[model samples]
Target chain A: MATAKDRAQAKAGSGLNDDIGEQKRLELYRTQVVLREAEQRAYDLFLQNLVKGTSHLSLGQEAVAAGFAGAMKPGDLSFCTYRGHAHTLARGVPVEKVLGELMQRDNGLMRGKGGSMHLTSVDHGVMGSYAIIGAHLPIACGAAWRAQYKGDKDVSVCFFGDGTTNIGAFHEALNFAAVWKLPVIFVCENNLYMEYTPIGDVTAVPQPAADRASAYGLERILIDGNDADVVYRAAQIAFDKARAGEGPSLIECLTYRQSGHSRADPAKYRPEGELDRWKLRDPIKIYRERLLQFGVAERVIADIDAQVRKVVDDATEACKAAPPPPLDIIATDVYADGGWAWRN
Target chain B: MAELTYRDAVIRGIAQEMSRDPDVVFLGEDVAKAGGVFKATVGLYEQFGPLRVRDTPISEQAILGAAMGAAMTGLKPIAEIMFSDFFAVCFDYIANEFPKSRYMSNGQVKCPLVVRTGNGAGSRFGAQHSQSVENWCMMIPGLKVVAPSNPRDVIGLLAASVRDPDPVIFLEHKSLYPTKGEVPDGEIVDTLGTAKVLRSGKDATICALALMVPRALEAAEKLKAKHGIDCEVVDVRSLVPLDTQTILGSVARTHRLFTVEENPRLCGWGAEIVSIVADEAFYDLDGPPVRITTPHIPLPAADILEDIVLPTPDRIAETVRRSLQS
Candidate 1:
């Protein structure tokens, strides 16, 4: 097997520290644990009819959300797809607010108006979690355009699946961003499947970023998304280039979903032995093992895990206790009631 | 006051707004260099340069959805959709994304933008190129639909739409682009939900919008001079915040309601107006509300077929006379 240093140099570029410091490693591990445990608890809640609507769990994709969250600066806007619970939590939106949103409570992120599929937090720079596939890509470019026009250094990040690359909006948005030299990052979490169908079956090329990046004149980088350190390092490279006005970049993260597509799906379409192999390379386990090798004590890791469980537990309890939104809220917020000619 | 075409009025309205607000921008296909397909944005590129007045590729999805994002991020964008029939190319963005962002976000974000597109059928652009789907837009909540009949109303409504803090679907009829009328020199912003009374009478109330407004006025004049029957014409400038109160008052006096539109008769704007009159002024109405509209079919490329299918001033007058006899 190749040494840790060799693997790091191959995946995350040369001359970088193979092992992250204890503090950062522990933070990454804790974030993943919280995300994984929270999703599992939310799934249980969904089964018991506590959380309404269908929620897509990101069981194996926690590391990507956590890593991107770590690298993003304050006020950097980001958008994600329906499978975006972990992305919201990773952005520092309280677990109470997220779980409350899923449960449709008054204290939810959007005051219970937007359910699981539409989580948004302008305060945390998590713009929206769109349910329509490949629709929000153009909106991200628009945000990037505003940032560029105002001379703001903040970069807009759009996280989507491998399937979104095939839509017409994807090509339009990418082409516009390239032509305008907008400051944004397109992170394609290539989880190998677009819903039930393998991406290879639908996409013309095996690797979407590598195939189409040159056509748009954008820089392409592929990384092992399960490795949090590698993801953070690669994202930094793209962010620096974008901040320097070098234009947009595309990063293809190779990862997998540990569970089915949604709350009700069984994912029987997945090939045999594929799940077992991917489970062996679970992101949380990989990061934990790497942290152990970095001289972090076992007891410390265990303590962090215990603390994460408490946070998830408390958040769930809070969500359960929250009240539903009132009926009068229906007529409110549809338009800014500014004494217009329409609002007679 | 100066006389200007409907096209020039559109340009003047947008230009005036752009000069008033630094954040107002214009983006569409050929809007910068080619000065728009209808020449509605002529001379803006030279005045605002490339940044404020941008010419995007033939991507309606990008133009519309990006306008939503830009509006949310502190820019008031006026995006052109080329033709109202092409809204299907970016319907999801207009219907699902921008319209609901404000409500779904609990009013945290607002899309202060105008989606300007040419609507209605008269120039024989064929089925796909020519359509008056204003009713289709009126059905959607969170979207304000406005169609002006002349140069003055076009300028006033366009300016009001840009200044408003929501998504406004400003529908411009293709046939009215070259129609000339006197327009006030300086800023003339009109209220959205207020209908204009083009003519006043007591025999019958004729409600019309867009291209049908002038035709309705002509029908009213004919009814007066020929039949000794006076008709009042109410121009529905705004479709969403419908000025039903004005229509109700006119219907009460005239005791007869007749709606005229250029769109298809089935489930069209005229149907909505008749329904409102039925509900609010049923006892006051002397007869059943009459709707004069085009037949339910795609507009043919030939001018003869189009003219036969569309509602004309004579047909409207005959409908009014028949209603009065009843």
Candidate 2:
């Protein structure tokens, strides 16, 4: 029986047949495998009490992060939501740094200051991971505005959940970015649920982000976020459009979260069979099958899986051995001068 | 020195910074073609051109968010919030995003931006438009707050704010825009967290900010003539990096402390000063510290009601006279 991947690959003239060769396909598969293994390790660490505080996981939403981050150039900026472990790892941020941050260690990306929700690595072009739902949309616009003002060819990509579409900042940012012709791409990963509730229950329109694209004078783009190839192709076109000075594009990627929203959520609110049904179409599973049909050897796929497991295992050991940030770190970095003194 | 209005000083301050640094950019609602609602930024658009001196929509969140984004990257942005009262509309950016970014990111990100807003009540814009909300910004830990009373301080302090590496909330009194004062010729710059003692006296220390500074100075003159109580008046230019040294020194010499404030009585900037004085300079007090402030009520639109609500020179002098005599 011909699968969806077979049909997609057989379409000779489609965008799927473009420059995303066997090497890039294998790379996309590797990214998803790494994200999956790393996130699974994080979940286990949380259970072992190694990861402190609250964390939002992107267990099933790896394809969107992997696809978008893979499509981006070196200088392109990425702004994502609190559910950003996958995005950070996909951006080439060391797994140990991410895991160390989650473990609240001295070796963390922010030296244990930002924690999981606010991961930032300017060196990797991951601008920030905003816990506030829709705040970074306008911030991403500002970064894009800077690029436009400086005549730089860098595009700013912002990722948020379906829930962010309801916030006032989301609308304001969309309008502002469109009016200024900013080099930005607003990617909404519609995981069906905005926290515990389904997005359709609260949203005014069926497709929250895509339906409102016309309001901001943008082209409506909706894609299957579960497929890495689809997301990667869409991301490339959007980046090209933004870099060409054609203004912003709002892309809604339809995907799902395999786990609960956070470690605290059991997701009791979900309908029966929902999680089980989505599990069959898992992003990693689909990509692995696609790689086989493309004539990539079975041992090659196994080697990638083994490599990802080793990376995750090494990161976990390093995070466990790392020490907590020192007490002096508490009062530091409040201002640009590296002091918290508000008064003489 | 040339005589300049507090409004023109705003123009000069911004022009000076924008001209000196190509990275400095300005944006707000109607700030470009309309020259700001208060007319404080009259010639910036014409001088800097559209790209650098752009205008924005009525989205306060977008305005400040974009400013933060730009500031974090490379450019130095001066965003106008129109009125200080609208800080309520975009308090998340001020209270959460800008102040917490550096601390949360552990200094990986820097927000080098200034949010200049028209503040205080005198134009009869009523409760919504006219408000002395400097205290709203003062409580936030990472923000630097500045409110200048005279034209000279306006030019100098604004230049300092633009150059500062952190986020600054620049409060310009709407009522003082038309008021004139002598401004020194050539490039003028000043420091943050410094208080200027306008008059030195031996009997009482009067500390004020923004619109209240001129009122406090006037009250000092009236007190000396009517009651023979000489008052030292200090202009508290910056609130976050507060000049407690100057204020405490003045209190130490005079042995009496008074604060003339335009904000409402509840949790005003004056209250903080009083608390600081009580904690550090209790031995210097000859009498209880007195705060002359507007009663804790929403400012009314009527001329008579508004006039009676805000602190006047007569009321300030009388308050000092009665407090000292008793």
Candidate 3:
């Protein structure tokens, strides 16, 4: 990994505007590795019956979360869909708390209240992970609106699947964000499939989110989500534009999900060899090779890989030992008073 | 004290909050510059300026979703849904997003916001535009529902709802917008989950909300003058954090209960009140608790049909008179 001094030197030497210094590239690579390992551990926990309810894994789509989260500054908000394990982990939330949430334990991110689909840590600026499709897009716009209203330099980044672009809230939020010039970035992780069906089957346009960008008077942005470098450059540009008060940008990243939509899905509907074909372009695999090609020491790559494995392992053990939340918590937090009583 | 219209009270209430807290923002379609479609929000845009008082495109979901997002952060936003009927379009935010955010996040996120909508029927806006949907909001847990009958209550309760940490659905009656009432000077902030006894009587308890409050008072007056039966009129203001104590006390004193509701008959707000009264104050009741409500049918544009369907003062007086006699 490049040190701060090395990164500064590299930035000084490289006159190219789009060059993300060695430090940033290494940071993105490390984020992808951590997300990938943590997500794989979550899958393993599900297989062991430790994880309760359903879980949505972003196994093959680490680059999108890593790139966007890396580009975002502190106080910037992130709103994502249910397939949000990667996004949550990428925001610097501990692997233990996230895993504990999946296990429905007292040590969970939300103390087992939110469970798998609704992971939220306001302290981390991960606003929420919404279960409903296209719901958080408008919410992200609102957060951006708040930032704009307060004259804060922070931006809001929203993530969703390709299916979300087809939802009514998507168009509503886009037009609202554009007209208001809200500092928000709408990132569509077009992972080929929308739940069980291929996005192309139901979507009217080829690039679901980007093609519809023109309708809202936004720039048409589409990129390869498998490459962390490409995604990082795009995210930085969008973030800069939003912070400069140029309004929201809609970026559709073409990617693929290696796992089924959720724990219950077998993903048998995927065509033969589709998974195999996507495996060649796997985000983590590509990022690791890219790091080596960029002259990052082999020892540095091995060290990060080993460190992430240990983190995931420790989180798994801790989550396995963590007890379920107390029954008394069931009625709490319904209102701001911390009680569920609707009537006297 | 000075007299003010219900519409003017809305502007005053919002202005009071906005002036007090820089974080409080107001948004809706035509709410800014255009002064809202109903003209209930006149002078707010001019007072607060464009950023604080915003007007959005006709997008209900975005309006509500944005409000929830803003609230989840550090802002106390007051979003107008224009008509209460449009809640159907953005029901996801009301039912799923706003109410569930704090609970689902285990108290990490607090949505201290107000969604004020023009509710109830009297303007002959037809089925789509006209609806007394406070009952729709009352059913959802984690929400504070408020429907003020007069200008004073509107300002007081709107102030209260804006200050409340929980999400509040403030229902401003469209019919009562132009009606005038006395409002005390200064920042009038009231409490949620409290009902006021508008007119006290010994014979019977007349429970009402929003549009029904005025009609219930009129019926009470006629019942006292004609039948010599004094009825206590109770304004059931906040529905979610229902002031059951006030209602039960009124029922206990009167020993009879009657609810006048403008919502459809099946699952109206009156039904819940009646059920509670029947269960808790069963022995106190001298007769079966009666509910005078709009028939389970879509409101029509015609004035005659609409007036006949909605619970009127005459119908309320006749129903109370006949029920007491039997």
Candidate 4:
């Protein structure tokens, strides 16, 4: 645990100046806020176009998504769960395609069939996400297993929520990855609540889900997920170690969700004091102040914000004008050639 | 033609496929150095090395997923589950993901993954280990299900499963592993979903799958030799994409129907076949069809208990007699 004094002094030891890291943190927060705004704009467009189903957004828990995504390598594969739009954006997916998907455009990532839960782009090494919780972890393990078998230096990443940590698949994946020395990383984004129930209410071991990884002979690391610099640096270190064939790592990011789990619920259960404390620890302001301290021109940061906002605006407009998937899409893509005939 | 045991034939088939195609690989628990608990993958690790013959952790999903991933990437991967019951852990991946991938990708990709598992209620493995999961897998749309009755079909079907463009669940019976049979010499490439007439008769058409095929044939022989029933027995080589024409055609000619399956009666694979054949050839039938299968219950561990639970030749003969009487 870094004290106020340690945080002030230790920042200089890791080649990460207190000022630079703070700026990086702020930049990430601002970027996440922009992503949230874009999500809302896309939602409005979805209302007009009404393509498929509901869209999941990371309105409050923006820091961890951006923080972890900023640290990934080009060849590294990321397997996400249902709430994956922020992770997608953080990994550099353009808002246009992201929103275009919400509108069911042919230009969407998965030809609009995936909606949000199944976002993927193999070009970016972004393995497909699934609506089924913790299911993709085994796939990540499999990819890592293949990499190790082929002597490839690639690492696989699995991102899931606190609720998914309890799934049987998650335990199975972690245990297997640990035993086989597979280069896979498990990230548990602990955002206080799982849908409506608080983590404390649901899990016997509260907070720092990474602790569970240690039971499988793997390293478990926990961090303030709101801090982008901390997340990026920690993720980079873990990926480097895993890619070196050291085995799997479990990283639990402590964060909070601003909205309900999805589009339907409004969270009235959170205590005001706890929410206020988190708001005060706003990673955006911290990074902006640090960036100012580092003599980064405010005009440059302002321009970046303006550019992001404009792109989201354009994406919003594009989604509004985009067409939905054809009705006949339901009947197609069931099987190739209907089926194969087997004869003696 | 070499006389090979069922288990030896499987190892030979895997060896042949791995040797024939560099892209073909084997994966399972202890499939490498241990050469499998049943020695079905014997000498594979030494031949192909560990990279090709992988020994994965005791996780059904990981084993199945490795096969799925390898197959999707142009590798013909054969993944073994130590027991058929363990497949329940990865039903979602095999049923939902691998099978649906080709269709979802609009046929751009082929899932050349073979999930080889041993089924049936024997070996005193009790309720947990002993299971007939063929019927469950056959219910899936994109997956091709094969239940081999003998060593010859074991090698032929496994080789075919490796070459098939779709995912195949090759359900081998645990009891049939040491059951020796004469495998036809030379390359055997039998197409899937083709039913072979093991016995030809004039009175009735009897359909059976997996271990029950031999039992049904034995019953058919008894009926012919003793009562002059002369029942024809059909071995349904593949369950999914069933040979409805072959089944219905025989029923159309014989005008009597019977089915034999190792699984439980209610809603088993037999019921589906019965429904399909009934809908197609009901008016052509001279008697009501009968299904000789296990009762709806988990298999017992004791041999005596299992015998009572499993479908026996006497029971199949009785069912065939009742079908003729009806």
Among the numbered candidates, top DockQ falls to 2
Clashes of 4: 4
Tell me which of candidates 2 and 3 scores higher on TM-score.
2
Q: Kindly report which residue stretches of model 2 are placed more than 4 angstroms away from their true locations once superposed.
A: A1-18
Best of the two (1, 3) by DockQ: 3
Tens digit of lDDT per residue, candidate 1, span A1-344? 22454345437542346545667767778888878998998889889888888899989988888888878999888898998899888888888888888888887888798889988898899888888888888888888888888788999899998889899988988898899888889988888889888888888876765467878887656778788887777778888988999899888887898888888678999999998899898899888888877778899989998988999899888888888998778767777773223424
lDDT, candidates in the order shown: 0.86, 0.91, 0.91, 0.76
Q: Candidate 4 at residue B324, lDDT? A: 75
Ten contiguous residues with the weakest lDDT in model 2 chain B:
B101-110
Please list all clashing residue pairs in model 1, or write none if there are none: none
Tell me the TM-score of model 1: 0.96
lDDT of 4 by residue, A201-222 (tens): 8787755366576688875566
DockQ of 3: 0.84
TM per candidate comes to 0.96, 0.97, 0.96, 0.90
**TM-score of chain A by itself in each prediction:** 0.93, 0.95, 0.94, 0.86
DockQ of 2: 0.86
lDDT of 2 by residue, B1-326 (tens): 99999999999999999999999999999999999998999989999999999899999999999999999889999999999999998999999899999988888889999999999998888999888998888999899999999999999999999999999999999999999999999999999999999999999999999999999999999999988889999999999799999999999999999998899899999999999999999999999999999999999998889999999999999999999999
Q: Candidate 2, which CAPRI tier?
A: high
